[model samples]
Target: MNFYKDLEPIRRPIKDVLAEQKLFTNFPDNWHVVVADIVNSTQAVKTGKHDDVNLIAAGSLIAAINAAKPFNTEIAYFFGGDGGTVIVPDEIVNKILSGLNAHKINSLKNFSLELRVGSITIGEIIKAGHELKVAKVEIGKGYNKSVVIGNGLKYAENIIKDNYLQDKESIEHQLLTIDSSELNLEGLECRWDRIKPLTSSLEVVCLLIEAVNFKNQSTVYRDVMIKLDEIYGEADKRHPITMNRLQLLTTFLKFKKEMMVRYSKWKIGHFLKAFFETLIGRLYFKYNWKVNDLKGQEYLEQVIAFSDTLTIDGRINTIVSGTKENRLRLLEYLNQQEQKGLLIFGHFVSTESIMTCYIENRNDKHIHFLDGSNGGYTEAAKELKPKLQML
Candidate 1:
């Protein structure tokens, strides 16, 4: 059953969403928390492989979501720039895992990136003395984001990391050859050039924050969000993507690189087809023309509204465009919180944000992923590591 789909969307502000525990629903015991991470992602990003690392991470979510589509299932998933986590029902777990396993193999073979895959049962999480609660918030006209509270997910991640480090996980994973029909990353796209802010003086910040105590997570997040708004304006004002300035970057090399994982193989012929399609896409957006009854202007608006700007899964992860002065103001509040033992945060600043997208449909079924160019969340988390050690 699509439990997530049935949950009522929280219509109030996020602060209200956090305070209303009554609105939070229990995660079904039959479902699971599946996670996959790229090993040594920091080192990989350091070598100018941020796009590669992010591509594989996005693929992890794509493969899993695409697999579920056949079964008419909707899953709640998170993209971490390095890896991702997904919540899925029991019936489709095996098939989703098959796609993820294939993704793992493809990752290693194609990019020399080692991907670690694992899963933890929701029932097992409940038994371990932690709670897993989920809430849905509408981000746009037809898209909703999953907000997970409590320490259960953090507990599962810890277990998964430990097991992976010890080489204790026994996973049966296979590769997707050209002849196989199991894995599909057809919706994944990276044609956009690095997105610059509309404001010439603004900077893109990739931020991550974690609460010290599980019990205070929701409230702490509420406060952080409120403070961010006071300093940076609303989410739309601070969103890193600017449609007016958005540009496309497509080359034969990019096409080849993406296809290596997208189709499990690349061909010069496919690039030619894509090259012509990009030409048409450019015309559509440039002239605001209607294609198949979908206007480019409307699609771009949806893109702005549906971009994954914030993700809360026992932590706060977001990308925003703001001035250096305003960023300092936001950081000031976060630093005070760190001193007061409420939360600790990490952030990286860059001239523009990197965008990777998954477009199942241009009309209404697409999501864009953003990160600061160079190294975004990965670098921010690196800055957060020593602070974590102090904890």
Candidate 2:
């Protein structure tokens, strides 16, 4: 068996490969899986702390990626609303874990959220009678999104939660002694306001969909994608991160507050610094000044490129903005298929959505994290489980 030096080069439109599931490659046995999420995200979201929850989850990814920069392959990660899943080569598993533990400490100190992170290896997964399949989806000119399939991820999640694997072997959690401030979050920014839909009647849907048979998973997901395109038109028509909708914090108090969240608590000098920076940012936004190649038409394209509006891993997950009528139409179509045992899905609706940005220099290395304002994917999964058992 031969494995490519990298997985990003074989990218295809997600819809194009749904019917050709064989294109996915088995994960290398030398790799390890790292999982992390907020421990009590639902309770936090109920208290209107979902934004913080989302930020912490996105923060964990940044920490892990920055930690894994020495690896031969880029880490493949999936961002759940309140947490995230990651895969990396075994050589850097401990390094990634250290970074995650660092993130966990920061979450506790800053947001008072407990972030649980643990690691498991691919060899154990295959030994336990499961497989991990990976594929890449081309989202933009040079960006390829990583997608994972198979029951291995879900199985790993269970192992982490239950400590099914012992401390020295299967799954292990480490508490690293390091300053959380030292964790790298270079591009993580929460500068934008909550995004409103294209219209008042429009609704935002966060969906997680899976098929009854693993072989049919991609095909069923492809149908959902087709229906969505018909209802919402092109990617630009439905993307929520538009430059026209961007607004920056101008008030001294609000800017100071944002600064505290992004960095540490403010000092007198830091407060004044934030005030001046806020004023400069206001001018930047008002005039739409260029950030190297990131301004004008190129910036809009980058926004769309970085937006996490839609994604496909083993399951089809998306944070989409559309009309109530179209949403109902989609559910009707999916439910009809569900009746035939073709697929199962969980969906949550919201009037608006939120975004977090990660920009590593503002040229092209940037991607946005998106989620429905409250209980988007998490709450929907609550309703989806019972249906899965019945089917």
Candidate 3:
């Protein structure tokens, strides 16, 4: 089913679907689920390489999409802070894996991060006795993000990690000898500087929560969102991204490096072109240039609109900007929820958050990604694992 069209009918929060069990449908058995996350991401984040970690994670999505060549085929993807998950037909799994291998290699050579990439089949997930149910969440007009609402993907992630731990040969053997010279990463950009909260005393919190029961997970998540509103106001009000906060870097080194990430290498002419483009970007941010019916202000709003700030992919995860007091209030609420057997939660707070953009256009096709500057989601995910495993 087409996610864009099908998700239009789903107007309620996913909690309704989880309660009814009718909104999610089984994925085709021939399809494969691909997951990639940076190994030792915690260390990298601690070492002050969080942006590289995020780029690698976003790059994984680019790798799979480029390799699959799914011009008209339907694909589903979810971006975690450290990496992401992509679902594609088995017919293109090998190609996608090879592209992932290229990404893994590039990440190591360029940024010194080891991206662990692997895939598993729907049959294997079913045989493991965990359900895999898929649905789409509509975020904007004709825009949506696919969500998986069962333990099957979580199981696959664990198995893949186990394989990475035990079978180095098989993992290495899966790396193909294909040429990735023409890597496709058309929509990704990181022009904006880090975003500090509106108030100096505020903090950026990244968190993940999983309920003890799948049946109650959505309800618990809805409560958490409600609590956020009560404390921090609407999602837009809590968002850290804004036009005044946007800044374009003019450093030649950063310009060259960013260009190289998209292109294998560049000539003098390419460098000059990129330099001019960077200037134009600065001008646009400064002058509020309209791109496809959206000024800088409207564009920043769309950036927040399409972000994965709060998401539910087998578990609820969020990267929010708020005051320290509000953050503590939410934590206390979470502890109370944990006490009541509603959910178990983990969170880490940082002084500032970073944004990365993937603008297919300034219109609804654009999406922004955010993570706390120093050890954001990686640290939160680490704290979450022990609790998630116990469930």
Candidate 2 worst ten-residue window by lDDT: 164-173
Runs in model 1 lying further than 4 Å from the true structure: 168-180
lDDT measured at residue 71 in model 2 versus the true structure, 0 to 100:
61
C-alpha lDDT of residue 276 in model 1: 81
Task: Please tell me which model should have the higher lDDT, number 1 or number 2.
Answer: 1
Q: What is the Cα-based lDDT of residue 256 in candidate 1?
A: 81
lDDT of 2 by residue, 86-174 (tens): 88877778788887877777677767988878878888988999867888777776566777767788778879877733553322233
TM-score of 3: 0.90
Q: Distance from true position, residue 23, model 1, in Å?
A: 1.2
Comparing 2 and 3 on TM-score, the stronger one: 3
lDDT of 3 by residue, 1-391 (tens): 2432334345565545545566778887877889999898888888988888887787778767666555445577777889988877777777777777777876776677888988899889988787777777666765676767777777888898898889877766655554656366666677667777777877788988887776555566667777888898777778766556666666766655556555545557867866787788677667889876778667666666787686677787788887888888888888998888778888888887776666666667776778887878888988887887786
lDDT of 1 by residue, 20-78 (tens): 78878898998989998898999999999998988888889998989899888689898
Per-model TM-score, in order, reads: 0.95, 0.88, 0.90
Deviation (Å) of 276 in candidate 3: 1.9
Model 1 pairs in collision? none
